[model samples]
Target: MRPLEGHHAIVTGGGSGIGAAIARTLAAQGARLTLVGRRAAPIEALAHALHGTAVTADVTDRAQVDAALAHARAANGPVTILINNAGAAESTPFARIDAAGWRRMMAINLDAVFHCTQAALPDLRAASAGRIVTVASTAALKGYAYTAAYAAAKHGVLGLTRSLALELAGTSVTVNAVCPGFTDTAIVAEAAANIARISGRTPDAARAELARFNPQGRLITPEEVAASVLWLCLPDSGSITGQAIAIAGGEVM
Candidate 1:
């Protein structure tokens, strides 16, 4: 609808799955984009296909994130919309969760959000109006049996979301988070694999286990999450800040 016409957007982890969907959806709404990811291949491919810019950087690295955002601002415009969609999750038993795992999870999921949001705050403030959407998971709102670390990190993301919303209260910038349940993405596939290995069940069975968590008996699609994000970026959505809308087919309820 060109609601975002003349705007520039930065989507972390825009290489595939929900991130890619968000990138394409924003592009469709007439926003020029800068896609960021650790790997260059997918971002390059997406940038080429969608006529967007691409940057390869690990979001956890403050220097790298600053460089990427600088490149994005130089190539496009001040980032008016930012989607903190880059995250990683691994199912580990509470007792077996190693220090490295915990640090890595927090680095990519929590620290990355902090770094990128801080890096983009000046531009967003300069714009006088901006949107910051973080793609958290339903785990942020509830505890999962074997996903303590992941859930904790996502909870941190939501905390940032709400706190930023309050901090920017009365400002034109709106901050919100979308919590999706059992989304059909590589993250789910990794979860399925872990479940299979741990529980000695077939991958199909583990996958089904996650699907059953959704009342619809199906995984939510990336496009669906993207649509929700697009909604938040609309001019009329300024009043939606500090909300964590769940796309879980009634599962969260």
Candidate 2:
């Protein structure tokens, strides 16, 4: 059965990778979608194909997020499921990261989750199957070199997820995080490129180095992460909350 049929769902970063995969998965489950992204082309294309609405907004900006969701609601009704999937990564030594860069990381990876979750909480609380799933990174659970800022923000994401989950434990809303490791996505591709550039390694070798982080010796798939998010949104997963489920192929226990 299409468990989410008619449910209003908002998926940020719905343009590609994990976000797009989640959007498609939720759409297939019969959820009405609001595809949120900074770019217009990709999300619009995906939304068109999925028969969903597409809204553009800088998710890191609270006012923009609010305005964008206002439009999304007009198109798809109140949001019941919020997927905080919009995020970026930067690889830099801790000493090299400036204040601006650190703040940018926090804004995109941490504060943006705050804005979107806050904007959708009321509707989620009202829905019979409210779900808030944030696409965090395995970095949240563990540490990595040249990624202090990114790791810090992601770790903050888990803290937010758990704290919110506790505060809303008695409600219908469930807050959780999916932490992926070296996912086969544009973000990973960028990381590979950065590694290649810095270490003068071949792109293939750099990617392989990342894959080696996982005990499974392969990169995680976007669909794999999406599947976990879909499961959490299901009615049967109601009892699960305040949890950070790792999709890192044992990269993080």
Find the candidate with the highest TM-score and give its number.
2
* Tens-place lDDT digits, model 1, residues 1-253: 5789988999999999999999999999999999999999999999999899999999999999999999999999899999999998887789999999999889998999999999999888777569999999998899898788899999999999999999998789999999999999998998899889989999999999999999999999999999999999987898999999899999954
Off by over 4 Å in 1: none
lDDT of each: 0.93, 0.94
lDDT of 2 by residue, 8-66 (tens): 99999999999999999999999999999999999999999999999989999999999
Clash totals for all models, in order? 0, 0
Model 2 Cα displacement at 152 (Å)? 0.5
Candidate 2 colliding pairs, count: 0
Best of the candidates, lDDT: 2
Quote each prediction's TM-score: 0.97, 0.98
